[model samples]
Target: MEWKPLPVGIDDFEKIVTGDYFYVDKTLFIKELLDMKGEVNLFTRPRRFGKTLNMSMLRYFFEENPENVSRIFQGLNIMDAGEKYLDHMGKYPVIMISLKSMKQPSYELAFEMLKKALKGEFQRHWQLVSDSGRLTDADQKRYLRLRDLEGTEADYADALKFLSECLCRCTGRKTVILIDEYDVPLENAYFSGFYDRMTDTIRSLFESALKTNESLEFAVVTGCLRISRESIFTGLNNLKIMSVTSQACGEYFGFTPEEVRRMLDFYGLTEDYETVRQWYEGYQFGNAEVYNPWSVINYVDSCRLNKNSLPKPYWSNASSNNIVRTLVEKADFSVKQEIEDLIEGKTIIKPIHEDITHEDMDSTQDNLWNFLFFTGYLKKIQEHQEEETIYMEMAIPNREVRYIYKNTVLRWFEKKVEQKELSPLYESILCGDTEKMGKILSENLMETISFYDYQESYYRGFLAGMLKNIGNYIVLSNRESGNGRPDILLKYPSVRGKAVILEIKVSKTYQGLEAKCQEALRQIEEQKYEEALRQEGYSQILKYGVAFYRKECMVKK
Candidate 1:
């Protein structure tokens, strides 16, 4: 099979079009977007749901003097729309801006991003000034003045509206505005506690042009979360929201099941069908079943190189787990249980919503999980229509996301533990107070580590997290050996101190932990655990063995 240039990280229309790249024609959705005829439309989709590329496509199809829109869509599916569509393709004024860059922990940084985006759009329009045949001398002079302005610290909305009016006068056409990731700044603000300021900045900016301006032809806004109507839209009655939960435009955002099957067929990886489906094919959009395009494309790219490597995680690469990590940090009992079920790939019962209604939980742990589910982090495993509830299962969608979310949460909780007084536990262990160590281990480690029925790796990971709370340490699992490797080897390093080594084991039988610990010690000797530690320059290694009983873990000598 011939390998096509996967758009990979390219979201620019001119770059994708003028350069050689594989294009998935979604111009059909462009027709549908236009069919709605709403002056202002908001589309809320999860991260890496192709919002940026779709906006770029919109710019190619509508921008009057786009640098190279015609060439980009030359051989695309839009050609099937005939010359009528092709003639109108590059014939409208377009103000394409993205708020994705506006993501920051501070209001000042967000404002800087906003300024940069506006400046970029202004420069694009300014370049078209010479070709703007319809602009009067006075209008041209005003455009020149706006372009010549230096300080980026000025109000962006007024400048953007002035540019829109200038474009309308210059092109004799209303400007089509594409605002990608419109909620990024607001989402950041909400997450980081600058909510009011971001809301005020963006709400004013959007209202000025998106709501009141007559020079605007139509606008499309894409974001992960939907800012409430009362906050962003305000009295803008013309606004229409096309959310992931919407029946229409759902299939347009992500690749449908049929599309996935056909693409798999095209790539000749149909043999790995079930495995691929299990990982990336759980997302459902109303009646149409979809797979994450980000993951699918990445899987295809992987298969192109190695015939048997299998598709790894892709969606996780483009997303930040801050939202999920924040959710996990604040998770309640019910949410923790649900998360446990998800990690086990078991279905969890819940309601799916475009916007969750619970105020206390809206931005909290419970609703964040719901947000992740609806947005595609977790997929509905089973549905009970009679009860009006859905059973959802969660998985790290891609390899990148798996490590990211776990590592993010790991670091977060690690910082929390360090902030508190952890010296008592460390001191107790260092002093070799077996009694005190036993009590602390029983209390602290037991509840912290959870065991699954047949998940040896999970048990190891759980133990690792539990031990990490002790102090700076390295826990290695499942290392290679000639005969067999130890289950886990934990190393605790401290300045001016002797280090400790822990060998972990799982108790399959209901035998007492003392017997288990004795067997574990025997295995450690057989596995040459002492040699492994001595090679690291430790003259003496204090060995401790541990065993688990469901959620309760015990340390044995």
Candidate 2:
């Protein structure tokens, strides 16, 4: 197999280029971006989709860092776009700052990070000044007079403007401004109760610096969530948002399936392509089918080291629970039923938000589905263009994300049932004591588990989910209903060949209970439940019939 470079867990452009790292040619984005001619571009992607690295690549290509540009973008696709831009690159006094490091517990630490980034910007400008030994008369005048621009709230923007002007004076080009994770402070503040203050501080600083600066040629801002432009860039309306849903540059952020397959072929891991797709290939932006790049690269690295076996869930690590919490809390009766269906590998119908650049879900149940879709948790299975409706569905693409969502859902369900009396029913079912199980079932389990009146499948599903929650039993539901029907079956594999089959029937009258129970038993017998158990290598089987009256349930053995 030919050698393949896996840039696993690497997002720095300089290291990726100079260290002989595997590079994906997202440099096509530079051409696309330059085509837009937007002075202010804002991109919102979920965390860790190579936003930082893309910005770094842009900085390397356009920031006028003459020495670094030559080394950083060598053998890259941007080179094909022509070197005219490279001559202007790094010629300006670029101010690149990342607010990601400001995830401090306190606002003071965040302020410190802000100050540190500003200082770095200042030092970069000073370094350029020191390198230009013989300054022009205009440069000399600005240089000597610039000492009076001391640090203050009013001076910060002017100071950077002055430096960019100085660079244009000396290098003859306007400076490019790059701000990464610009929403970090607000995100941190949202969780920490400092949202208003942080918003105020950042707004003041950003509005001053980015709003009316003549020395700035263009500015780019990247963040996970979309903070309102009105809140931060309360400027004179020159802003252009290039969020993931935007057609202008969506292809550059995530790895399209074609790219993943091509890279797989390059590494001779094409045999594991389906497995890779199962884990990371559900993300779609318009017509583009993309995979999470971080997951793909990490999987490739693991596969390479292990001599080519596909890896599990490389992108789930970066997901945040804040949004999931919002989704769960805002879920309605329909949402709960839909979620259970999704967990059980069934599809549900709903509308999804095409543009989900925001972090939180709307407080409505229907909106939760839209939120899930936008954040990439749920995806569209089919579209009904005639009706203007999308048939939304969901699955755990990778094990990592599966684990996270499972744990989160488990925790949520656990918390809900924590103070409720679950011991009686749980113990009754575990002990295989039918009478007590029936009493507990009638008393509690039937009422507690979520169910839909119209969706009998969901009621059966709730029973299954409940059985699994009870103990280490191989609980299987909706197995084989001969005439295209659904049967609820449970196999207690951990109980040393102890297996149980439950058949449920709903009745409106007490007299009909016995008849429904008899029908359930007859169906089990007709469907050859015993034969299925024998085929499973279990000779003996315990059978039970559960009858339901509205929310009330009864079990008989």
Candidate 3:
């Protein structure tokens, strides 16, 4: 039997339903929204946790689309949620827009892109607004100006509110606004050096459209971070925020355990449930234990294509994932120790500042932890409220997120190694200064946070990264020698030039490092590791054995 195609990158509600793709039933999110009835609702979830699809679902359910009369929401949970909830369906005009595409390099460009996006939305509703006899000549011309992208920056700021009013006049019903990834511009601007300008522009847009607009029946805004009230949603007293930590709508964003199991069972992937849970489970949104929906879908799809494929980091590619990099790069001594502990599968406690804006992101270690917590890199295992501040115990969510962190830390370590003054390490290896070489090796070893369980391969890679920048000698890893592959080999260009061989080992304990180094040296000699270099006519050859026990190292020449 063939299975329904998984919606890999498709977020459109109509497309997913009409095209018969496999969709996790999140339609109940509509019932919850209508019941809450906030003037504005902001949902804070991670990047690929179905925020856009949920918003798209909302647009289809609430928007006034008379042409779609085949019951697009037929047989969903929302349909059985009682007629009171369904009564609001197809009753309001929707001003749907996604700010996610506004990730631009400059404020001018971001503003232009946003304006063009609004122009498309205007075109979507152009016929409705143009046919409204209640709309005056001035409003019609203004709508045309916005639809053609002929409006100035100031005119565009109030365009959303103005369009909502025009639609209200057309249908005698208020408009429901759905904005996806509303914080994208702010996030992009924060990193793009235009935060203040973008903030002001967004502030005006939200102020006119959400804060004081009478034409709005309700609005739902989805984004990753909940920008502080002072930063963007200033004075919007009616804005109800359901963040990842909020217990109200947690199950609607990511997949619950039962939902995931059923999805796995549907695709005959039930046997791989444990592996899937290990890699994708552990995220705690509210009190609901959930799996990364994006990763689960992609993994199930991969299993369909190739039954033996293993799960990898799927959500990491959906976003930049540089938050952890900034956290690791700017970590202080204590923070560095905490990070090392985290890499060792330990939990760290941090003050949970849920109300954070992009401006203060990564400014301090505490803020960085909050950013990581909300951005899905870390999972909230435990939490408590003390006085007024909330403290959370967070750990790496799963292997997939751990893979991201380890990769980031490895890259950061590699960059630090590249930035090191290799003249000393190079000189030590050349002049046979094993003392300086061991010291430098130990120092560099101590600086790296290993997630590979401190295996011999990790140390080998570390040594290779350090030696890769040697001025003249070329470094080769695991290259075939006379009788065996050397852990590392660095050769000078000329036949008369010097050569060096490095053999690496991992010790069980600190005291065993010296013995392991000796064993490595014995392997180098007994295996005739230097015979190939001698065959190449290198007159001088130096050999060293390197061993590591956790952060300590031993070098023997």
Clashes of each: 3, 5, 0
lDDT of 2: 0.67
Kindly give the stretch of ten consecutive residues in candidate 1 with the minimal lDDT sum. Answer: 445-454
Top lDDT model: 3
lDDT of 1 by residue, 1-557 (tens): 56767777778867876776766667777777867888999887778878899998898788765276666677677678766556667778889888888888799888877877777877777756567677778666665555555443434546667778878887788898888988778777777778877887787778888878989999998887766667767788888987755677778777887777777777787887777786677666556677777877887777777979666667666776666676666665576566555554455555554544223245545467676765556655545444655444445443344444455545655565556565676676556555565565556433331324434555566545545666566656664323465665556574334556556666666456556667667777777767866777666466666665455455655
Comparing 2 and 3 on lDDT, the stronger one:
3
Runs in model 1 lying further than 4 Å from the true structure: 65-75, 81-88, 127-142, 149-155, 191-193, 350-364, 381-405, 412-438, 446-454, 461-503, 507-545
Query: Candidate 1 local accuracy as lDDT?
Result: 0.68
Each prediction's RMSD to truth: 4.7, 7.4, 2.1
- How much lDDT does candidate 3 score? 0.87
- The TM-score obtained by model 1 is 0.81
Model 1: lDDT of residue 248:
72
Instruction: At residue 336, give the lDDT of candidate 1.
Output: 55
Which pairs clash in the backbone of model 1? 64-92, 313-398, 313-399
